[model samples]
Target: MRFKLQTDYALRALVYMAAKQGENCTTDEIAGYFQISAAHLGRVIRRLQNHGYVKAIRGRRGGVRLDRDPESVNLGEVVEVLEEGAQPLDPPTGEPGNGVDDALRLKAVLRRAHGLFVNYLNKVTLAELVAEGLPEPQPAQQPSEESAPAEPQPTVAAEPEVASSPEKTPEPVGAPSAAPGYGRPGSPTYGGY
Candidate 1:
């Protein structure tokens, strides 16, 4: 359910590049703006270059720029490229056919859900995200005290205090132990004889 910080940085870096279309962007510039590590941004830029999302130029005035138009770049595709082998959920693993079928079933359901999420994302392009003419933020209005709902107070339960007296520790494995009353050898309540 959580994206890696690298993914977030990749998106930011791409956005910055897209916004500065026609202008070459340096790793130091992107890193400085985003407050990220320059070395890390360099790695990200290199990966993007390898993936054809960006083109790097060399020279005193050279830097990196987007290879494609912002409108043509799909956010979902970019995310996929950046997170090549990432899975939102871990694969299910447990003893087979021993009441573990439910866990496997849940895993399948979650996988399907994640697929649907990605499918929705695929429909959105980066152009939509970086579009100009965004709606302005509305000013917040102070609510009258009489009209405002009272904040709910959280209830905290007191925890039972443990005595400081030292208790007897259980016998270690392979050590001998006395049997308890009314229990057969190897019973669940007592250690095995």
Candidate 2:
């Protein structure tokens, strides 16, 4: 039902690389573009390199590059590999067969659900994800002389708009304390970054 942080980071980094069309990029570049921590992304990049999904180049003009073609990299395969050992249902704590039939059945169901999720992702590739297009990088803002030091003016605050339906409502900044299936920040369940 939920992916680990590594999985999310890997997918995001891959998509960014795929969009670049084989151009090499630094971990900090990708992290900055996504507004994520470069340190965390660096670890993810190392994992990706170890898996042969990417290669690292050392030198002033070097950076990480996708080793495989975007079309050949399956999203499902990436997720399944990165999410290995992440179980929705933890193993029974007590002795086996100690009123655990229901738990066993639930584990089987969860496995099947996870399989379905991967199956859906298998139909998509990194190339397809990049084909959707990414947002353009924002340029740094510079103050202009015309906008310099204006006199303060009193203004009335406008009321916030209320949506008629929950679906129409905008999500609050920083999300909720814990997302539906995600854990709270800094917790083990917290999706990495």
Model 2, 25-125: lDDT tens digits are 99999988876678888998999998899988889989998999999999888887788756678875666688687788888899888778678879877
Give lDDT: candidate 1, residue 24: 93
Best by TM-score: 2
Tens-digit lDDT track of model 1 for 1-193: 4455566567667767787876898999887775667787798788888888889989999999888888888867877787785775676577888747887788788888878867775886556555542112221122353258659766554444554777655554444235422112333222110
Candidate 2 local lDDT, residue 134: 48
RMSD of 1: 23.1
The stretch of ten residues in a row with the least summed lDDT in candidate 1 is: 133-142
**Against the hidden reference, what TM-scores do the models get?**
0.64, 0.66
Candidate 1 residue-wise lDDT at 147: 56
Candidate 1 residue-wise lDDT at 64:
92
